[model samples]
Target: MADLKVGSGEDIIITSGLGSCVGVTLYNKSTKIGGMAHVMLPEFPANREQGNPAKYADTALDMLLDKLRKKRVNLNRLEAKMAGGAQMFNFSSSNDKMRIGARNIEAVERILQEKGIPILGAEVGENYGRTMELHNATGKVLIKTVKHDDIVL
Candidate 1:
């Protein structure tokens, strides 16, 4: 796991091996300011509390938004792009309790929608893992899957 940090207008953020995890990249086209959060869970953790709030999906969205706002990047002018939600493991049980990837993807979409951010593109929900890069300067997202190599969006 790379050091997850919020980036400014001229920075680039990247993450790798997004299996059953969601990577959300929020960027402002006008200012080229952005942040990328790799959230493992959809919501806040029950077992632990009161640490780095930016490590969770729900709180990370708010934290990143606040940082961008301070930089004069309006939420309304921002665009979101997501990647990585893979059903990487196969379970023997017939129970429908192991849909972590789908759940994470749903949670990310819902949070972005609630925050009034537009989704420019997304590549999610497959059996393969992905490595993603968010270019802050252009709001251009590049995704590379295990089999497909590199794809630019």
Candidate 2:
């Protein structure tokens, strides 16, 4: 479920089957340049040195930013949108670590804040899975859920 992509005008980036995973998008309206990442974990494991950067919120964002920079995107003009991050299954213990969805959301928000990127919209922290679509041309995100109506963020 870990994946990331960057694109320009008219490019629609889509990720499906988001349960505890989160979908994050960064966009620059003026340039019509943006990126999306389907983040599977909150952070990278300290013991690991190498893996798919897209698998963690922290590394995925970093990779996305780097790609955007390579594309000459203005980081100062970036805005963010997010969806998914659902608490897919019920947990018996009240352990925060099991709350992967919430953790993923928090990690992304914190990183965006540290980078001074404002979040323009979000649809997170529910109990159902979601599918997200990023319309790079319009800088709009469409959130689709099986139990709810579609949301445009």
Candidate with best TM-score: 2
**Which candidate has the top score in lDDT?**
2
Task: Please give the CA lDDT of all the candidate structures.
Answer: 0.81, 0.94
Estimate, for each residue in 1-153, the C-alpha lDDT of model 1 and write its tens digit: 322456766678899989888888888777778888887767777888566665567877777778777778777888889898888988887565488788888888998888788888999998999988998877788999868878777
lDDT (10s digit) by residue, model 2, range 25-51: 999999999999999999999999889
Q: Number of backbone collisions per candidate, in order?
A: 0, 0
Cα TM-score per model: 0.88, 0.98
Query: Alpha-carbon error at 58 in model 1, in Å?
Result: 0.9
Pairs with steric clashes in candidate 1: none
